[model samples]
Target: MSEKYATIYKTIGQNIRRYRKEKGFTQETLAEKASISMSYLTKIEAPNCDKSFSLEVLLDISSALDIDVRNLLENIYSQPTI
Candidate 1:
């Protein structure tokens, strides 16, 4: 993952937070469902962005969210058409 990817993940993190909250899952609970440590989820959710992420971790979260991984990634990286 490169620095350019970090911004996309950061945006994805925001969407994850919004959706996760809407679904009524606490961070800790989501972490458990995603099979990630709470601390790792915290890092992912941090305002400070990073592109370094495990694909496995992403898959877990995507499964837990009941959303397709491609859709999630697309949502993360999509830019509005002018």
Candidate 2:
């Protein structure tokens, strides 16, 4: 993948981690709530990890976190290119 897309994924992952922490939800709990595996959640939250997640996954995460889908992508577009 290109650096720009990588940055976007990283930014979104960071936002997810931040919100998940703020909500006091562990990766396991969030994964169950989002109907995904803990391993997948770990991958998505890993900094510098080059995994690509789908929009459905993002929506599931947002729903599990009780936040808007846009919240998970907060500051993504503004992130500097890698």
Highest lDDT against the true fold, candidate: 2
RMSD values for the candidates in order, in angstroms, are 3.3, 1.2
Error of 2 at 72 (Å): 0.8
Model 2 is weakest, by summed lDDT over 10 consecutive residues, at 1-10
Candidate of highest TM-score: 2
Query: Which digits, one per residue and each the tens of the lDDT, describe model 2 over residues 1-82?
Result: 5665898998898899999999999999999999999998998999976788999999999999999998898897787876
Candidate 1 residues 1-82, lDDT tens each? Answer: 5765677777777766766787799999889999988887887877774646777888898889887766456566374322
Per-candidate local distance difference test? 0.75, 0.91
Q: Report the poorest 10 consecutive residues by lDDT, candidate 1.
A: 73-82
TM-score of 1: 0.77
Misplaced by over 4 Å in model 2 are none
Off by over 4 Å in 1: 79-82
